[model samples]
Structure formats: structure tokens, C-alpha cells
Target: MDLELFLQQLANAISLGSLYALLAIGYTMVYGILRLINFAHGDIFMFGTYMAFYMMTSFLLPWGAAFFIAIILTIAFGVLVEKAAYKPLRNSPRMSIMISAIGASFLIENLAIVVFGGRPKSLPVPDLFNRIIHIGNVSVVSITFITPIITMVALAVLMFIVNKTKTGMAMRAVSKDYEAARLMGIDVNFIITFTFAIGSALAAIGGIMWGLKYPSLLPLMGVMPGLKCFIAAVIGGIGDIRGAVIGGFILGLIEIMLIAVFPELTGYRDAFAFVLLIVILLVKPTGIMGKNIAEKV
Candidate 1:
């Protein structure tokens, strides 16, 4: 194995992994607090790209402005989805909630297909994201490098909020014991909506970046990333934010390296992630950073 080739592959993995981590943050956050998987989370991401497309082409908005619109709409949609599909089920069983999430995911995907059409659409490439910089012997695109930096910085800011701010405290409170927080006069709805908003925004950012990198937009595009990110979240210890990031990078690295080294196994790239996930489950069922909750009997 060429060590230099392996390192280059590793770099590629980090770029892809960062994107997965960004998306997994949303997934793990919702699950951490509510144990509710927002299946529509992926579609909210899909809508984000559409919002950007419309703003840029129809409204003649600048790329930055269009991206901003996409983020706003995605957040709003996420909040609304929680209100419509989840709030009422706050008292429901975990299985029912998971089903609702699946239903919501399907709803958004079908609606997107109807509105956006079944054909794939090209995403607009702004001049600002077109730069390419060389690192050593490796050539990296501006979007690829900038994307991970932006994701990490945003995560740092989020960590500060979760660990230091009032809202973050409220979030922790909700996650720990929703009823107690509600009794303490925490606005459950607002907190939940806020959580969804942030999660959706992350999904949107990931979606936009994925579009820019792949340069293709389709309603079903979020499926693969969504699944991979979910696995990453689980592998990183499902509810741990930092774990999600670590898991994402690990997953990305593994996938990229596996394909690079064993070019013949490219078809099994996705299978490798699942196999790894299963192995992790067998060894550390809680995941790399997953916490242990001691139930009070």
C-alpha cells in the first residue's frame, strides 16, 4: 500500500466525513432529547436545495442570499413538522413515534417529487465557491475544504451554547427530564421547536454543500447521506454531539479508504458501513461515545 496514496485518501474521507457529521448532529440532537427520529429531517434538507434554486434563478437572488433563504425555510419547516407530526405524539410509545417519523419522511419526499419533478436538476455554482487550493501534492476544492471548517466552527459555537447558555441549559434539562423541565416553567414547545430549527438548519447546510460538491439536485438525494449520517451517529454514541463528529470522520475515512485500496469492492462501500456498525454494536452497543442511563427503579 502506498502510504502517500493512503494519506490522500484520508484527506478525501475527512471532507466527506465532515458533511456527514453536520447532518448527524441534527439526527442525534433530536434523538437525544426526544428519542424521536425525524425522518423528514432528510427531506427538509432536500427542500433547502430547492429553496436555493428558486431564489437564485426565479427571484434573481445572490447565492449568499439564496442560501440564507434555504436555511430559514428549512428551519421553519422543521419546526412546523414537529408541531404537526410530533407534538401530539409526545405521550405516545417509541414505536408509534418512529412510525410517525417514517410517515413524515415519506410525506416530504413525495411532495418534493411532485413539486420539483422527478428529474434531476443542476445546482447553481456561485463564483465565490469556485476556488481551488493545493495542499502538498493534493488538490482540494474550496467548497470541500471550506465546508469542513464551517461545520467545525458551527459545532464549536453550538457546543458553547449547549454547555454555557440559558437555552442550552434548557435543552439539557429537557433531554434529562422533560416533565421536570416543563414543571420548572420551561416552554417545552419553544425548546422543542428550537431544537428542530437548529437540526433542520444543519441538514440544510449539509444538503447545500452536498449539492455544490455533487452539482446535482434530486428529491431522493438525501436518502444515502441521511442513512450514512444516522449510522455515524449511532457509531459515535447516538446522543453525543462530539461522538457524532468523530463517528462521521471515521465512517468517511473507512468508506473512502476501503474503496481506494480495494477498488474491486467499490460496489460494497455502503455494505462496509453497515458491517462496521454491526461490529460496533456487538463490541460496544452504546457506541463510541454513547452514554449509559441508569434507570431509577
Candidate 2:
């Protein structure tokens, strides 16, 4: 209602949107290549968070080093999951692959519960990241303000890697037609593995940032962001990189605005997305930027 409140809400939306965008990129990239929804992605995100926790607490590593290590381990976990679970069923019925993904998700979540315990842990935050910067009517912490910029830069780098490099070409080819790509002498397995690696790495960045922003670390923390990011990918037209970013921002704005206007609906935040999802599916199942893909049956 007031300018100050509006500005604060806007800041919150942008910060929240950045995290969504990072998470959505991974979803969109994997979906683009494999045409499979990795249900375990959320758990992979949780893995990243735990990796960060171990690096910081056990290894006594600096934040930057811990973050990098988390990325590496999380990426490895994702690749291993693919090799063990999804890859075996790559040639099987689509439903089989989907089920494998679901199984993997369950395995990771249960394992996390066993390892991290049922109790929630608070993420260790450095003092530097705790400072708030007040500019004009908008009051956002330095970490909050800077996070979106970092996320956007990361997205830009990802776009360059996916669109401008040789590997990028191979990825595009696989996404377009895997069999055709293989026939063209493209290393299908390598490209698929690379895709998973990058996707998982990006998810790690998001997980770390999410932990930094919210300061809560748990096995289930990824569930909400993972689900929300999936919605973002769908809204932006699944498989489209730019679409995912746009969708993330839009979804973030909607959620923040709804919560700001009607605090009571805070309980309905998840419901809000499904409602919007259903409406979008009814109106444009292909999403805002999704193309009508016709397959020769």
C-alpha cells in the first residue's frame, strides 16, 4: 500500500526470484536434453546443502572454498545418480525412466534423513553477509541485493556455454534428436553426462544461496523451492533457457505480492502455484514460450 512497503516487497521478490531462476535452469536444461523429469532433483539440491554444511563445519573451509567443493560433490552425485538409476532405463519405456527418477528421489531423501537426522540445522552465516544496506526507500541486506546480480551473471555464463561452445552444439543436437545426434557421431553419453554435471552444479549454487538467504538447512528444505522452480520452468516453457528465467521472476513476483497483500494466504503459497499451474495448463499447456511440439507417432 505504501511506497516503502512496496519497495521492500519488490526487493524481496527480486531476491527470491534469483534463487528460483538458478533452480529452474537446471530443470529446464535436463528436461531439454533427456525429456525426463528428474524427480530426484530436489534431493540433489538437498545434497548440495549438506555438502556445503560438511565443507564448512567438518573441513573448516572458507565460504568460497566450501561453496566450490559443494558444487563439485553435488555434481558428482547427480552424475552418479544418472549412471546408476536413470541411465539403465534410458531405452526402456518412458514411464520406467520416470519411476526410476522417483525411486532415486526417495532413496536420496531417506539417506539424507539418516545422515543429517530429523532435526533441522541452521546454516552458518558469516558476519559480512549479515550487513543490511539501506538505499532510498528500499532496505535490503547486501547479500539479498547482490544475490540476484550474481545469479543473472551465472545464467549469462550458462547461456554462453550452451549456445556458443562446441559442447553446446552437441547438447542442442541431442535435445533436438538423440538418435540423430548419435548417428552424427556425437558422444551421446558424454553430452548427457555433461548436461547432468552442469545442471547439478547450477543446483548447488542455488542451494548454497538459498541457505545463505534463509539460513535453514534440512533434508526437506529443497522440497518447496524445487517444486516452485519446476513450476517456473513449466511457466517459462520447459526446455527454453530464457523462458525459465522469465518464468522464475514472474513466479517470484506473484508469490511475494500475494503474500504481501494477504498475509493470511501464507498457508496457501503452495496452493497458489498449483492454481496458477492449472490455469496455465487450461489456457496454454505449452506455456508462455513453449512451442507446439508434434511427434510422428
Q: Which regions of candidate 1 deviate over 4 angstroms?
A: 1-4, 294-297
Where is the poorest 10-residue window by lDDT in model 2? 288-297
User: Per-residue lDDT of 185-236 in model 2, one digit per residue for the tens?
Assistant: 9999999999999989988988988888888788888887888899999999
Cα lDDT computed for each candidate against the true fold: 0.87, 0.88
lDDT for 200 (candidate 1): 91
Model 2 TM-score relative to the real fold: 0.97
What's model 1's lDDT at 147?
A: 81
lDDT of model 1 at residue 55? 83
Q: What is the lDDT of candidate 1?
A: 0.87
Worst 10 residues of 1 by lDDT: 288-297
TM-score of each predicted structure versus truth: 0.96, 0.97
Give model 1's TM-score versus the native structure: 0.96
